[model samples]
Target: MPKVKRALAVEDLTKIAMYSDPQIAPNEDTYAFVSATVNDDNEYQSQLFLQKINGGEPKQWTFTNAKNSHPRFSPDGKKLVFQSTRSGLSQLWIVPTNGGEAQQLTFFKNGAVNPEWSKDGKYLVFTASLKENDDVGNQHEQTKEERQKEKEQQAKEPIVIDRLKHKSDAHGFHDDKRAQLVLYDVEKATFTQLTVNDTDHGFEDISPDGNLILFSANLDDDADYALTNDLFMLNLATKDVTKLTDGNGSYGNARFSPSGDKIACFGHEYAYSGATLNELYVFDVATKERTCLSSKVDMQLGDVMVGDSRMGYSTEGPVWSLAEDKLFFIGSDHGTTGLYQADLKGNIEVLYKDNNHVFGFSYNGVDNTFILGISTPTNPCNFYQWKNTELTQLTNANAELLEEVSLSEPETITITAEDGSEIQGWLLHPYDFKEDKKYPFVLEIHGGPHAMYGQTFFHELQLLAAKGYVVLYTNPRGSHGYGQEFVNACRENYGNGDYTDLMSAVDYALENYDFIDNDRLGVTGGSYGGFMTNWIVGHTNRFKAAVTQRSICNWLSFYGVSDIGYFFTEWELGKNLLDDPAKLWDFSPLKYAENVETPLLIVHGEQDLRCPIEQGEQLFITLKHLKKEVAFVRFPGANHELSRSGNPEMRIARLNHICGWFEKYL
Candidate 1:
């Protein structure tokens, strides 16, 4: 008898393994990576795995129940350093690659992260949070008793805000501590502070000679209002700080060339505000002259494809070739992220690209090999090895679970807007679909009016398809993966071109696919997508049911409530509350809420700072006051990232609510 396959379930996420951050060892033959999966307690647990690129089974290197990621190999390939929460807070730990016990490396009070190895392997540089009066090494990890006392004291203190950017989505309220870099001498067991400032410093890379440390920070007194991040170098011995780039653009991910004579980075001047495409640049260290190497390339020079499955961060870089003449980095174009190569003369060429999503990769300059973290519509995530010109699959992380369950594969689609421009999207058929029956369709929109929805595996979209709904997701005019012109089309023109593009997608699907039911249509989206969902229901009655998540309703209140509202409103809408309140209100969906007739479900995270919960509450209360069909669901302790990296239990509940709403009305 053949094996039976079942439709995917919301709980299946626990069984699915996620792979990321593949780092090739110095030997060029072995590599290390991080694998994560949901535990029985509905918490995500990750560990490091080591394997050989030539041929061998992966060995479980760490057995901790907490997240152990950001693995970096030593220059001699003798040891591996990674950040883990096993010691309570996130801290760096080192373990021998051959096979040995892991040893704790740092014990900072606020924990340490972003570890980088010096060339001689004698010094390890990492970033840690420190107060203005705190010493680097003296502030060891606090004991449980001391931590509880500190927590109680902090709880009694009121948060006093003094800066425009006082809070963030990741860390709720701003504290006195700032991020700084520290050097750990492995031989002497002593720590040396490299930076001291109130503004947070981002660790980029250590030069080959280990004399200068590269970092990015806005040291201006009014950095809270500044939009650019300037690169700087800290001399390890003399403690002298040198500014590199001019104060004109935001630059980061800087790497020193082989000889440390040149520094390559990715950044862009805010010519178009937040929608500006990041370009590649090289700085002549001696003369301090900067040149744009990707001036001709019209693609974003980093992974911009939005996906929920990716967990850890991978260093997408201007990784130098041994000869120091060429550089390699990831670029997003035409709904795909691929590796590209460029030289000093501004010439560029494709290195590796396909229909799959290359979320992360590690390149070895010695033999010119690459270890890639790839994902597709049918596969959550897996590892692949690229040697010479051939590609080989390295790991089948979810093979067993995938074999037991059936998944829907999306078909590429193109829609022509009323103005004759083309919009790209993908459509997935209902599982076990038949041509004779018309199935209800759900239109899914993505956030980041600047982000793109591509070939990556999206669990939420798949869940809708498995529940017998034809799912349609698209990249509208403002989404990335298209050219700069297309992405900037919706800036300051919200609810104009982007709104038409989304409606055009629905029309194209209804006309092209006969299996979709026009009468029982539904729509849903989060963040900007959520904003559109609300806008769609108010502007038209085509959708019978709508689910708006982490949405924005009243632009007037949003201007003061949201974390990014102070600048994002002016940047994206070309209007601020002080400049033109009327224009911002004109683009808001709440202005037309009285026209909504469809049953709408408002979902929001209570702890969300990006699109604060008040955005949803105002819409719900207004709709209720108007006697409109509306329901609100709020997740406690959940932030804007709740749909992606929030509590696993909440993620499942959110998915259930979405499917239930469609089932009741669509």
Candidate 2:
């Protein structure tokens, strides 16, 4: 007898635990990671867990039940320091490696995050929000009642906007402030302010000798109007700051090699504008000379592969070899992200290759073991240990929840685009698929027209398939994981080439698969994908329904309202509204609103700053005014990340809205 499994339900989203941020111990024997689950209060609760390489049950270290992250091992590996929000604000806390009561380290009013250990483990450097003026420290010197009154007064005060980039999508309406570095002496229990510049000073990594701290900040006089972040180091002993890279481009992820003679980083000149791939570089700290290592490798240095998860993931670390000759990093290639090795002589090779997507990773040279966070179409992102070319799973946080639900494994599909470009995609059959019966189809597009949809688990797709829809998603012209030239293809020629690629996928599916009903087709996407969804319906009425989330409608208004609008518009569209008004209007979906015949469900977060709520509002209002079939769904107190890592309730509601809209129209 065969056992039947239950199809995945939308409510199962909250039951699954998302794992990320795995930090290996200094000796590579033990590792600490974070796991997030929705608790009874409907708020996402993240806790730190410790695991050994040998194999055993993973132990929960932090019972705070709030957000706890960035688990780091001290030099001696005797203690672990992490950031926690147990005291109502995120602050640094330490716990003994063996086991003991968690000890509080900092009480800064604005809170602290991203704790970095010095080579000797004597000092800890971190970043905190600060007032732009810098006349007073960030600590809250006022009492509780006084603070309440201040908040009350501000609620009734008039709104003000002065800075060109005062608001960010991650951060809410904070005063025009920058994040600055602060030093904490673990033994002495004292705090020292490191930099007092008006610009943001973010900590990167400490030198091997522990005498200097490397950071990146835009110190240009007109920083607000320009995009520049140069690498700099502050001498702890002499309190001096020195610049390392020229202002030719933006540089970040600076790390000191084992020998401390050179710094390996990931960045590049905006040669191709925003569509440019991040290139790897080696800088001589002593000579101030730089060399781009991955110039020959056209792939992006880190993972930008897109997936649907409550906890986000990306390939971001750049670790050095024991001999400081070769560097290990992650690269997006052919719809999958994998480990790659680079040398000082401008050589690179793949150390690990697989069809799965690598989200987060860490390497420990002491034991020669690697910790990889990866995901597949059926498997969620989890930690795996690699030793001597052998692999083992470390944590299966979602295994229990997944045992009760059924999921479809996506089949990889490849097709040649109109321009001879290879387009990679995936197709998921209905859970109860029958070859004799026809099924409705939905095309899912990813955000970041630069992001790739690869071998990863997407809950929304699973639900759509369970409801008898054939789900098809692809890596179009502008998607990452393909080479640099392919990623930049959809930049200036938005609906021309990329639109053809998407339409070609639909045509390929209709020709190859006999189960699809061409008349009952749908489309949905967020961000750039959202923009494409609107464009798809306006250009052709092939889709019966469409959903655009956190979308952009008009480039003229987007150039001013979006946090990075003014520059992103020029970077993506290749022209600002001021330089080419007619072209901007020509590409805007708002200009073609009268051509839309498909029913649309506009979804957006009220607090989204990247594509402000007004973008969705304008589209919905225009369609309604024209007596078209349209509806709008807004999530309050949510941002652009509402679908990914936003509040659990809101995320579930959003998934429901997506499915309901498709059910009603398709």
Candidate 3:
């Protein structure tokens, strides 16, 4: 008899392993990547794994129950350097490629991260935080007692805010420290400060000759308000700095060509505000003239697919070929992020693309081999080696767990809008789906109104489907993966076009699928999706229940509270709080609170600075005053990324609350 399969549970999130950051060795025979899994203690542990290109089970490199990511191989491929939090805070650690215990490289008090090896393998460049008055040479490791005292002192002190962008959803409030580049001599074990400035500098790459370091930052006086990153080259011997790109545009993730004659990067002018698609550019080192190589291509560069299971940062590069005649990068188009190649004359060609999400990759330009990190709707993540137009699986990190659980397969669909436009979406049937039975339906809206919903694993969506609810998610207007015009369509008209697109998708589903019960309809989303959920409930009672999370309800208050609210309002809505408060109020979901009759659940993170808890509080209070059917759930110490990377227990609880609410109402 065949073994029975069980539906995915909330605790299955702990069992799923996520893979990212693939780095191929110089010899092109082996590669290293990160595999992250939630522990029994409800914390995430990421460790490095190595495997050969031919085929074999992956060997674990690090044993620390902490984050070990951003692995970079040495020039000779004998050693690997990565960032780890094993020493209480994030620091750089180096380990041999074959075998040996890892050694700690940096002991800076403020922590060191994002280590990169120079082509010569004599120097390692990394980013470390330092106060304005602190010297790079004076950095020392603080003891446990000293750290406790500093924490106590910080609590007693008052937080003084003066900058427009004072707080971040990741690091909380601002401090006196700013990120700066530090160069370390591997043989001598000495450190040198490369650049010192009040503003933070992002480390990019070290030139092939090791005479210059490339970085990106805005050094203007109004950097606090400007949303631009300018590329800069610093001479190692003279300490002289040279600016590359014009200050009008933003650019980063630049890399020097093999011959060091040119540079490739991804950037664009804010033509369509924050919704502008990124374009590929190549700069001539001799004259500093920049050419847009991907101007003819209509796709957005990099992996813009939005999913909950993918964790950690990976390179989505404008990687240069060995001949320096071509470049490879990832592009998002038609709801799929695929690899593409471009040349100096603006010619493009598809490399490897399918319905799967290629989130991270590392290429060996010499052999034309690639180690790619891919994720699908049923699989959390796995590593594959691609060569000669063939793919060989390297690591199946979640095979044992996935074999015991039942997962839903998403069916691709396109919805036609009223304006004769096409919107892309996906529908997932219940895990225990039966064709003869009618099932409750749930519509999931992704945040970032600029982010795309694609072929990646999402734990929360799977849980809902496993609980016997048909799930539908779409990339409406204002979402990426579409053309520039489609992405910018909902910029100034948030609720007008985007709202109808979502409703039209729902209508299309009901008209096409016969197993969905229209009466047991539910809706939920976060961020912009959260705002839309609130708008839908206030405008129509079609949804039997709704859950709005980390959402924006009042533009007037959000403008002053959210970290990006000051500029995002004007960028997305074409109006600032100072320029036009009335219009901002008119577009707010709180304005239509009186019409909401459906049962609503308001969920938010207390520490979220993106949407802020006040946005949810005001909506809840207003609905309560009107005697509406509503409930509020607040997550303590959680930020905007609670759903994606929050505490494991909190994540499980959040899923339970959402599924429990739908089960109770629908």
Structural similarity to truth (TM-score) of each candidate: 0.99, 0.97, 0.99
Q: Give per-residue CA lDDT, model 2, range 1-666, as digits (tens).
A: 656778888888888777888788886778888888889999988889888878888899988668888898999999999988887778889989988998888777667889989999999999977775543233653455765888899899976977786778988665756788988888887778888888888788999899989999999888878787899989989998889977878898889998788998988888888888898988898898988898778798887878777373323667898888888888888788888888888899987778887778888887666898888878777889877777788877688767777788888898788888779899999987899999999999999888888877788888899888999999999998878889899888888899999999999999999999988999999999999999999999999999998999998899999988989988989889799999999889999999999999999999999999999999999999999999999999999999888888998899899999999988
Tens digits of lDDT, candidate 3, 1-666: 987889999999888888888888888888888888887678999999888878778888888888889999999998999999998789999988878899999999989999999999999999999886666666787877888999999999999988887898988998888999999999999888887888999998889999889999999889998999999999999999999988888898799999888989999889998999899999888899989998787888999998889888877999998989999898888877778889889999988998888898898888887887888899988888778888888887888888899999899999999898999999999987889999999999999899999898998888899999999999999999888998899998988999999999999999999999999999999999999999999889999999999999999999899999988999999999999899999899999999999999999999999999999999999999999999999999999999999998888888889998999999
Question: What is the lDDT for 228 in model 1?
Answer: 85
What are the Cα lDDT values of the candidates?
A: 0.90, 0.86, 0.91
Give model 3's TM-score versus the native structure.
0.99
Looking at model 1, residue 557 earns an lDDT score of 84
Give lDDT: candidate 3, residue 255: 97
All predictions: root-mean-square deviation over Cα? Answer: 1.0, 1.8, 1.0
The clash count of every prediction, one per candidate, is: 0, 0, 0
Which residue runs of candidate 2 sit more than 4 Å off their true CA positions? 132-149, 174-176, 310-315
Q: After superposition, how far is residue 613 of candidate 2 from its true place, in Å?
A: 1.5
